[model samples]
Target: MWILISFWVIALAAVIATIKYRKPLLLTVPFFAMLGFLVVQIAMVPMPFWETVRFVFSLR
Candidate 1:
């Protein structure tokens, strides 16, 4: 739940940052790229709580 919420929050932040900074593609692209890397890193680590909850409640 928290992870999902945080993901959306980060996405929203990226969008807002892009708009405010007037660098829509430039800002958002790298933000999402780094976010993807962070998610992969998290998956590689041993996070029982988040991993289990994420899998159990996965929407995709």
Candidate 2:
């Protein structure tokens, strides 16, 4: 999907910008936050995707 592609492009841009200019908190913080989110998701590897979605949503 184009949306997915664009999302990745934006994420890549953030990473590149962070690398090029290490002084921007706006770019660096979100990049690390997203990376942390992915790490947590990876830790949930044993759960099914639907169950993970349900469990996470149920918390809020």
Candidate 3:
């Protein structure tokens, strides 16, 4: 669960940094990878999007 959250945070940071710096194109790789993984994870969730998000954040 935490790994999933971390993936999102890392992907977001990578995207922002990549945009601001415009040097490290490598960041796009992880951004796309995490985007794919996130889509799969969201698809697998039995509940709705908001509920799944709430559940993920609710973890200790």
Candidate 4:
């Protein structure tokens, strides 16, 4: 999805910037990348509890 692509683009840009700037913050790139993944997952999928409740209620 577009959201995932944009998140990766921004993350890549941040990594490039960190490299060019030679800042210590570059060390956190992995964490930021993981956080981006988490954001995408949260955006794309329903939470397990919500899905379970939806299915349970729909069965009536």
Candidate 5:
């Protein structure tokens, strides 16, 4: 199962760090983009998990 609890924790930490350090907002944008990409890749909700489905049906 795709898990996001840890991601949320890390994101929260990043927010805290940004507040403390005053980093540029652009920095967080990339971080969130990457996170979204990984979440989609792991969850396989948009696609199958590398299970190679055949397009054509064959006679048994």
Candidate 6:
């Protein structure tokens, strides 16, 4: 949950910085964001795949 919050916070900050500086953060930021998500994925290594799938479905 903290990771999710941090993701949004970082994204918001990145967008603001990009707009203020007139840089190409639109292209570069997503790669880094996806890398952050990949790290979160790696951290969930012990959870069973089926459990994760079921939990995803339960959210709906």
Which candidate comes out best when scored by TM-score?
6
Against the hidden reference, what TM-scores do the models get?
A: 0.45, 0.41, 0.47, 0.42, 0.41, 0.52
What lDDT score goes with residue 13 in model 2? 80
CA lDDT scores, all candidates in order: 0.70, 0.69, 0.80, 0.71, 0.59, 0.74
Residues 1-60 of candidate 5 have per-residue lDDT tens digits of 234666566677777777888985734764776668765655664445443222112324
Top candidate (lDDT): 3
lDDT, ranked from best to worst: 3, 6, 4, 1, 2, 5
- Candidate achieving higher TM-score, 4 or 6: 6
lDDT over C-alpha atoms for residue 25 of model 4:
83
| Model 5 spans > 4 angstroms off | 25-60
lDDT string, candidate 1, 1-60, tens digits: 876777677777778887888876745665676668677766776667597558746957
| Winner of 3 and 5 under TM-score | 3
RMSD of each: 7.0, 8.9, 7.5, 7.4, 8.7, 4.8
Off by over 4 Å in 1: 26-60
Worst 10 residues of 1 by lDDT: 26-35
Residue-pair clashes per prediction, in order, are 0, 0, 0, 0, 0, 0
Clashing pairs in 6: none
Better of 1 and 5 by TM-score: 1
Task: Give the C-alpha lDDT of model 5.
Answer: 0.59
Task: Tell me the tens digit of each residue's lDDT in model 3 across 1-60.
Answer: 987787778778887888898868848777677778777797699999888878887999
